[model samples]
Target: MKLDALGMAQSTLVFVVLGLTLLAFMWGRFRYDLVALAALLGSVMLGLVPAEAAFNGFGHPAVITVVAVLVLSRGFERAGVVDLIADQVLKVGERLLLQLTVLVGTVVVLSGVMNNVGALALLLPVAMRLSREHNTSPSLLLMPLAFGSLLGGLTTLIGTPPNIIISSYRGDVVGENFSMFSFFPVGASVALAGLLFIVLVGWRLTPHRAGQATAEDMFDTANYLVELRVDEEAKAKGLTLQQLQDELDETIPVLAVVRDDKRSAGYAFYDALQEGDILLLEAGPDELKVLEDKVGLSVVVTPEEDDDSSTIEKQPEHKKDGNNKDDDDSPARQVDTEGLQLVEAVVRTDSMMVNRSVRQLRLHHQFGLHLVAVARDGARLKQRLRDIRFQGGDVLLFQGGENEISESLATLGCLPLAKRELNLGQPRKLFFSMAIFALAIIAMLLDILPTAVALSTAALVSLLVGVLPLREAYQAIDGPVIVLLGTMIPVGQALETSGGAALIADTLLHFGSKWPIVMTLTGLFILSMVLSNVVNNAAAAVLMAPIAASLAEGFDASLDPFLMVVAVSASCAFLTPIGHQSNTLVLGPGGYRFGDFWKLGLPLSMVVMVVAIPMILWVWPL
Candidate 1:
């Protein structure tokens, strides 16, 4: 293999891009997708890939493959396939561990046959609902469920992006194909073991900080105290405050009363309400508005101008004014004219500030959000100011200006916490949707249909059969990932075509020729794992697959073991969220520290390697 100066320059550019992306990931400068696009733009500037091929990855079969998988997953979701499973499996009366096991098991089983991230998306909301109902921290369940999804993807070729990339590379390397279940035994073993760990003690070990609060806590309604008018025609116009309370369930209290410009400070409970009398009450904004409407009353404009005041009354005529404007300066939008307001956000596990105190993140200095109270389960932090290490699922009660809440949460990889209150509006064509997907996978595995053809067919069927809206089915696929994957495929092909992989392989093998085949495979696995964490896993697979095959050739070993090693190792994205999509999704939800992964993931990766090696050797034999 030979490389001209241009080729070397291109390779150098690629390496530089990889280095910068790693630094950006560590620095939290931008999204991983954005970083990759930036690197691609850099490659074009350096003329690494010709202008024509710059956008080639967008059209690649692999890119199409990922999109098709996403659409298919959505089809299944719309068909109520996952919801059906949940209906039967997510029983409320089950033991905690049993419930987790059933939920995690279903997620794993489903993910093993589909995109793991897609599987997680379907189950996440269900888990949130379960957590609320069980009065437990979602944090305790989400991490284990997420890890289960990752493990489950190991079972099938199309389950995760890396596996598909590895199998495609196998065709390029040894002129062989990976069967749908070629790696199933080994992958399934590891998945089962990992799932057990998650069910038995993993969820239990997590901090159950989410105390007793319901999902409603995440959307804290603003409280307001206002006085209302009693119109002549209103039902409560001549009723006493105590009489009105008796009729309307008495949840609201009439705090004060005023009539004929005279104020009464004593409890207004027994005071009679006249047409012009004022009744002061405390309630949330929505509640107050509803009460005003129901009572045919107008809001008191000022503290002194109660219902009894002789002033311009009745609902004011609609007019264009600064008050009606939606801009930040508008008083209507002002929760805190003092520049402080309350908000709620979920803590992500991978946040750099996770496991750190509010003082450590310097909440006010860095993000301008003051920690008001931290809620876990339904329980509020007893000592909010002094003791609290943010963990995943701990909902923070925040005091900050509008939009600062979102900005601050983004920095922590957290999100404005949301709960799934399902209103199953309609049931789509479930049977047809499931039939199409099942047939597609079967056809692909039977060699009667190519995977791309099968999946694309399934996606189309979903639209035609009314399982997914035509607009929405297409919308489910990520455009940037499609572009990145499609564009990079040809570049990777050019690398292999030019013997760049062979050249790299020769150098590695030359230095370790005396090493046994197992050791050689292990070395390649380690290299693949490291590269996948820093760069895109699919890109890492493209770069390393051919090298792994070349190494097998040098050692006179079966290419199957080497290919499987590349597949498994590339998917073991344990070190960083940037390594995998599932990891990134959990970053904000788990409230995990960036450094926290290596604690659990590093050990899991080792277990995968140790378990996979023997299985690969036994099943595929070197």
Candidate 2:
């Protein structure tokens, strides 16, 4: 195919636009969506993408496919499908390795059938709960789960972004769509090998951290510590020390005792009595209030050197002054008069706060929220308080006095980043959610309608039926990702229209001429994997699918094997969470170190390459 001047110009423009987008992603100079939109506008100005075709990707079958998958995945979550599967799989707890085998295997199986990210999302909380109950770090279960999710995506056409892109490209190339299980054999083989490696060797690679140190110990909160003096009217003034256990109101922990300026050791019990005795506690606002209210005591949060500590010690002498005036002047009383509550939240992988310190974000200054401590994986972090950068899945122990920090959370653009303290099966707006999603998937799969139409219908039904409130359902769909997909789809179509794919195909074939078709196929698979890791999987797949199709045409080889290679490889995002949204989602909560992904993922990637190559050759024939 000879390139026309227009085709050459458009191709050059595509590279420029892509370069800008990548620069923006790496530089953190603008929102990703803004970058994508700017690229789209630039493409139009350069005449690379036709004005009419610019918005077509928004309605493209591929875009619809992802949206439908996300909604359907949510529906399955509401139905307890994941929990049900986990319950059966997690029961093999006696042998730790065997349990991991079951857990990884089950997730892989589920990922094959559903959207892999949704599958992981559904299973992650369950894994965390199991870890907590079993006294194990969530780190052990999460890496395997992430790997399994990636593996599972290889088994189905709609399971991951790459598969759907490859399938659509094949339809345009060979006049046929791939069957749902077209990539199953190749995907399954790799999944099996990956599962074996994870169960046997992967977990041993993680860093070891001791279990469950109190927040005070972890953050060295002694700097924030102070003494509280019990007054004659206080309820705790007459109670035994044993009455106060490890926790106050199931939140704060009581640390130690101080009396007459002297500190006592050894845990005190309910039989100990005191007046003018001092107590040391580890807590933020909410728990502190509960301690004051439940025990009929007052809080003394400031350090001993502060006025409250000195004045409380001299309170007997202060009785000579009017008591009401003294009470009104107390700092503790003033603090209580101001409503404040502390909240514990996590930084989600999708959040913008990744790799930024709280001090940089000016969390307290701008958000009216103070960061107390950050927990990652199972380890309580001890970093320079002002210098510690927040990553996705970093559990933030923060102080938020009311307002729910709603505006701050939005401005930060991070996921709640914290797992809600709710039971897995606790009922909350589930019935309606399940029905809407089920109807959408069934409608599309049965060919009763186009997928986008069916999903749009369901989105409306969900809203009307009150299965999903308007605000929440809208928020569920990530607009930035949607816009990126929508804008890129048109550019991909232009590449097809302009014969740019043929040029890429010719260039690759010149180098690959001596290679067997299967060898060439492997080369394409490896290229897709490399591109997927460096760029967003969806964007890489969209660009590479056309080129893969063009190469198959150039060789007069069957398109299925070539497409299968792309499908399997594109979904195999194993090196980093940034490669895929699902990986990012689990990063902070799973407490995964950046390097931890490749510990299990590298072996898995190798397995996929080895297994997928042969399976593609055998299953579809080159």
Candidate 3:
């Protein structure tokens, strides 16, 4: 059939550029955003995308909605909304199967309403704490939780960037976007099936690395942290760390004594433990269980299999105060007026802290941060927090204000291990935060406002109502993702406007000429899923939405089913950690190898495809 196509020269150039761009993304060499930016510039420079419209993608509805969702997710976090839910997940008892069910279920629900990555980050610390409390390895919970986030994101329009992109693409092509809940039927159905597999069977496929890996894998700490609970009438109440060691005769190293929220690290050996003090021990899972059986002391933290030895107590470095050169400053001396926040961070290889003691740097006096604990390598650090010399890969716990901790960590060349828990200084407006988010969803459902406008209004209201601070709202937007979306959108437009997408659709149609229409739909779904695994899902959606539209036109079929298929498949990035941010976030903490994801991910992927295609056809119709 005679059809419109770009000039051969232009189409070839577009093909060459896109081919290189995909290669760059798969190589994983440069950041995806940088690669997208390069593609946009190349298209503009080659006159494929008009120079005037090169940056229009930044203002795309999809990008705005993505940013708004991220901010709103942060607002929910700051308001203590999800944390309250996490408290319930913690109370679900100690059974691994039961724990996986509740934890994955909670994440799935949360992800449908918020950014999936943010939902995972909010629950990650809780998962770590749960492992310590249950005496199991984090590996069993983390991968499932990450996968749950991806599954959950498939269930709603704002749940993931790909959904938003798909919906917006419909508006550009068909003169109207899919309604907010249009995806709910197919998406929610597929999510339930995927989650069923994850909680029931997929978690078993994950590696159990609690005792096999370093403490750094759990919380990026130096040693396994087991909390020793001291009861009022407990036999170990008045005993010192040294006395306990002597009594046990096995020399278990104590890392710190926690009273209330105060932590005493590098404390004197003769200092007696109080009735309610929680002692942080450096022992692993096997020894912790053994200690419980041997002594009357109950283990507060969960056990991981380890019998590792730790070094104890270093001498504190004395640094002179500026006001009085003869007076030494204390690391724990003056608490900041803004309030204290406990933060976990990992020192970078190039940190100025390397080989430097906290006492020497006067961390509290200089940066308003107090070093609470430090762990190096896989070994226990015996030295006190103040006396210990910092090393690369050392995990540090610090006490500082919300803003101060962030700035201080950056200055010290440290990366935070978890999302900052609500800043103590900030207010938690749970009612306002939830109400705002709900109203935004309501507006979109009622068609009173579009998705982008509603979400942007909700985010703005969240900022104004103190649900999330202005500074944090800015931080909530993922920079690389925003850049990638902004750049890729224009290039995607170039692909369609230049007839490149139609050309690809023609080839796909030719290949399926003798096949059933259902087979053609499956081919598009699989293509989108595989591309998403190797690149950003947003990019996958950006590239595939036009192709889906072209294919729909070529087959004289309804575009809704084709667009719906693209939306679902673009989010089925379960095969690799690089496919989605949720997977990458858990990799280090879960101690997961690159290939570990597919162990669970492969079966889970099959489950999604099995469920999604039929559901999409039924819900959207061919």
Candidate 4:
């Protein structure tokens, strides 16, 4: 491709726009979709990209395939695939090495057939339980699991967004996309090598993280749990458990009811409260005061909370300032403590609670649940309950009815870190999920349908057959991710069509061509891997694939090996938490600091690069 004066000017403009787009991505201040859109609009305005093609990327095969894969990943979850497989992991016993192997291996296999992040989401809590059970730091297991998901993504087309995007670019190049299992030969080899290193050696390289010393520290019940006596004139006297929450502008969970000297809580939310009914509440001193004055409830002091070390010991003395001393002097209340379940759950990347405060969740009003304590990065949050904003991977301690806890966690988009707490899934849906997935693979293998068409049709069949509800299917589609892909595709084309990629290729070859071809390939892999650590992997692939193709031409080498190198290396985002969602998902729960990933990830990256270059050359044959 030749460039005249105007075309050269346009190439410079594309370079400027892409530089700024990359900065914005690494800055982490703005959402990626917004950044990608800005880049596309800039390219069009600068005459680097045609204005007519601005919206065409939305209808691209890559965008559709990403959407369909997301929905299908959710369908598999709703069908108990993870639950069924997770039950098997618990049987791995307490041997740390054996546990790590099975844990990383399970996520690896699951990642090959489903979205890598989705597969990680299903297994993360299981990994947490293993950490808790073995009495080891979550840091040991989490980072490897995150890295394993990235490795597993290399094994299949739909495993990660980057693979799908790479395949689309390949389709545009040769008029045919890579086959469904084309990645398996190279990807599986790299994955198995990476998985073994993580299980056997890399896990020991993780930073020492010390927090949440025991499971008891997970639930904050010392001062928060209390007994409230309802009077005849109380606002809660006539209302059912849920109704009381509905009426209050500021509500606290009524943990249980004490009636006629005995406690009864079954159907508590549906039953109406009566006079003299004592309600067990999870509230702070401020909320307790609000209930005492506004709801006409009285606090009953129990014999030193449930624990001797409880900070609630001084609560009775603090409230002894006078008028209500008679109630304080009454015999210590015998509170019934049955059927209440306190469970720990992690906030997921897709959770609605992300960036939302406890006051905003309205969990009690909606799900009859109480937020007892929250731990992030392996330590309990010290901020006020309402001031605490949630982030992905934050561990939360919730107190609710035994049966209601499971439903509430699913509704709140949090995964319980407890054992065998997978969603209540039907066996029939499990069959449906697996069967539909197999059929999609068959369709692609036989070339009866294209990868995008086959997977989209399978996703549609899952919805029609009720593998997942219609509402959930819609929720499964990540709008921001889809938008980022659709908008960035055209901007990426502007980089190629505008001669910007040719300019970059010339600069790269000028300095890099003195080395052997293997050295050049190694540099490309290293550059792509480093770029992936700083930005979204899909975006890295989007920006690099064109430059990669251009570089292959400059070297007079076949494009398959170069493309394969880009595909595999772009998913090697092991050096940082922000590199991928799977890494981000393990951030808070693993108690890792910003600088922590490189400890394990640096060696792991070198391993992947060493193993991957030879594998790619041998398999794809440059």
Candidate 5:
């Protein structure tokens, strides 16, 4: 095959862009999304990819399917499906191996139908809790759970983005796409083997880090000392301090009591409760919120109230003042606290709020956030929370809408602490979420609709029915992953159009002609696995699918084995945190360093290759 000058130039440009992308991805200096976008722009500028088609990847079916799957995952999470399952699983005893089997296996199964990252997210808190209860390091459970989620994606077409991309490429080449369960035989075989390995041996290889710390300790909530006032309508008004403590489940301790400005220090257990009495309490933000809701107590306003209101209590009246001035006939819009959350954030040295007080920042008036508590190390804050100046290391607990809280935290340069599972545990819309997801899966398996359309429709229905709020639904979709996919798709096409993929395949066949076909398949699998670890799996699949097809055609063999190899290998990105989103998701929570993944991942990857090669050959017959 003679290469034309234009073809050679295009191929060279494509390879150059791909090489730089790989370097950028490995360097970790820039985010993957930025790297991909720069590569796409480079391709367009070099005339390797058309400018008009540069952004077409964002609208691709694979991208759409991923987005839909994310939205659906959020729906399942918000509906408390994982909590419902955790309750049942927690009853099965605390045996480490058995717990590992069940928790890892559940995430694997869940990954077959939903996004793997979402599956990991749902089970992560459960795994942490189990770790605490069983007195085990989370490192033993987290890596296994992350690997299980990746392996589970191998079983179904929509289980992971790479599978969907490979299936779509197959449709373009062979005129018929693989079915939803087309990957089941080989995928399930590999996933089950990997799961067993993790259950039996892989976790044993994990590094033992400090993983038994409770969420409170992880967030450093020991210094939070807040005061609440007993309201006239409060149930605690008539109860003694000890009775109030007992009613609160004894989780929080009442430190002191101030009645009519006379302070009674040290465990006011025998003090009688009275209206307008201030109770100094030692509790975290979550406990404080729960106490307020249960007893109808209000946060005590600080004595040094500046001209500006400095407490949550005064904000409503302050807003009402505006309403009264604007129109006496107009009713004020009440703040919606239905889905409000209590989040802990620590002010960074570079934070905009580093030297500002809550009163100076006007957090509540400007951002709908009310400062509930603030904790500073080495010294107890005795003044009003709003008047307390926030230093670099100050941890502040803010209460507001979940979305607003997240945005405010970012805007103020504060890092959120460990996320708390604050679900009502009722699974309010569990049946609705499950039914919709089931219908979508059934429709895909039955070929009633395209995979993208079915999942997208289910996502839309989930939003319309309020299974997940609109804001959360949008947040569910990972923006960087989408951009990486959208940008890389066109680049993959450019490689194929320039005959670069064919050249790579011809080189592989040239060398593999003397070897067995299984060796060739194994080579492809290993190469894809390496690429997946170094870059995004979707990008690996997109780049390798054409090469796999070309090799099959060159050798005059079946395409099934080649594509199957690509699918299995692409999902086996266990070598690095950046290789797969699931791994990255667990890195911080699992207390894993960058080098920590390979402790167990290297062995697991070998296991995948050993188990997957024969399974693919037997199932698809090269």
Candidate 6:
């Protein structure tokens, strides 16, 4: 193909925009959305993408479907559907292989319908508990579970970002979008084969990490030891420790008793509690709040009252006085406490919090966060928490709203020590959420509506009927992902329009012309897979789709086979932890090293290639 001056310039500009986008994504300094927006604006400035059509990608059917799927995933989470299944995951036998089979299998099925990362998150704790119970290394379970989620995403249109992008590309090429189940024939075959390999042989390839500890060991609750004072009117004022334990659902062990200025040697489990007595307790941040509310206990803030405490003095008069004026009228007070969470975090060396105390930082007033407990290595600090200086590596337990806690941790330069457990909302809506989701899937399969429309309608119903709160529905949509798709879609179109895709395809075909069509397809699949591991999978798909279509056109072959290869291979990012979100999610919990992934991932990738190529060719023959 020959290109005129304008055509050549447009193609060159598109290539430059794409190259910079790839660099920004790989750089990891800026958020992906920002990088994509920069690329989009650059394209418009260069006349590659028209300014009038710049925002069209946001309204693209694929983007809408992704948004709807994310909202539905949140609805299912809030409805406790995943939790109900997770509860059953615990009942699977203690035998390592059996437990892994059940756990990985369940996650795979869930990932097929919801976000794969969410599926991994839902089952992570269950996997840890199973490991602790069976005395098996968590390393064996986490990686396989992560892999299973990735595998499951291949089976449906809404399963993964790459699949959605591929389907949208197909719609543009063929004039009709793929049905919800179109990916099923090839995806299911690949997933089943991959699952078998993971179960029978892939797991054995994982490195045996020694001294695998449970969550309790990793978090080290003993370091969070602090004292709570018993109020005169407290419900447990006269109760023995044993009696108190029976009354409360969660265990808050009394490690010692402080009477006057003297401390007891050990837990006084048989001793009766008394007013004004300080009970040294071992509990996480959330547990401390529950104990205070139930037993009328107060955190014994031991730091001397500072006369010039600006944070406290600057508070609103009503809040400063701690008076309950119109408690019934205050919606903040009426809000359910279920959303409140306790999390442990570690201060990094470069954290702004170093050398500052909680009182000085005014954490409670500024961020709505409370420092419930602090842990320092070597020895315990005897001073009050407010007086204790923060240092690098100090482990602190923070209590606050889940969202607030996450934001505050990031702002304060703290790394979370554990994964926050998913909050399965009120149990009443589980059936409703599931029924609505099923109906949407049915509508798509029956061709009653387009995939995006059916999903969007279902998401709207979920919000209207209160399956998911409005705030949560918005939060559920991954903003960066949406922006990446919206921005990259136009760039991809530019590649096609400027004939850059054809140019690249022709250049590659020159070397591959003599190779069999099957080999060419395999090479393209392998190329997409490799690129996916190094960059974002969605970006990989967006970039590869144009070239895949161009290659089919050049070879006079069916586009289905080529696009299928792109979809399947783009999701197979198994070579490294950075390749997929699921892999990174398990990195800390599994105690895995960067190099550890390829041990099992290498074989699994080989298996996927062997299985997927045959399946793709058979289902959508070239």
**TM-scores for all predictions:** 0.68, 0.72, 0.72, 0.85, 0.71, 0.73
What digit string (tens of lDDT, one per residue) describes model 4 on residues 215-261? 55444343345677788788878887766655665546566677887
Where does the lowest 10-residue lDDT sum fall in candidate 3? Answer: 312-321
Q: Which of candidates 3 and 5 is the stronger one according to TM-score?
A: 3
Lowest-sum lDDT 10-residue window in model 2: 332-341
> Which should have the higher lDDT, number 4 or number 5?
4
In model 1, where do residues sit more than 4 Å from their true spots? 1-14, 21-28, 44-47, 92-94, 204-428, 494-500
Clashes of each: 24, 11, 10, 0, 0, 0
Comparing 1 with 5 on lDDT, the higher-scoring candidate is: 5
lDDT for model 6 comes to 0.76
Q: Give the per-residue lDDT digits (tens) of candidate 6, residues 1-622.
A: 4444466566777788888888887766666678888998988878778899999999989899999998999898889888888777888887878887898899889989988866775687678778777778878998999999999999999889899999989999998777888899888888888889998888899877654444334443333455668888898799876567656654454555667766653232356888888876655445565777777776554344343534222222222222454444332222232222556565643355767877578676587665655655422333456567786546566666655677677667665655535456676688789889999999999989888899999999999988998977886677768888899898888888878888888987887999998888888988999989877788889889999999999899999999999999999999987677778656655667778898898889989999999988888888
List all candidate RMSDs to the true structure.
Answer: 13.1, 10.9, 12.7, 5.4, 13.4, 12.8
lDDT (Cα atoms) of all candidates against the true structure? 0.65, 0.64, 0.75, 0.80, 0.75, 0.76
382-462, model 3: which lDDT tens digit per residue?
544545777544667676666666777766767576543433233449889888988998999898999999999999998
- What is the C-alpha lDDT profile of model 1 across 296-351, one tens digit per residue? 56565544334453332222211111133334322223222122244556654344
Better of 1 and 5 by TM-score: 5
| Candidate 2 lDDT over residue span 394-486, tens digit each | 666665545556557645655443333333443444666666666766775676865456766776775676554455554556566677788
Clashing pairs in 5: none
User: In model 6, what are the clashing residue pairs, if there are any?
Assistant: none
| Candidate 3 residue 219 C-alpha distance from true site, Å | 8.8
lDDT of 6 at 258: 69
Cα TM-score of candidate 1: 0.68
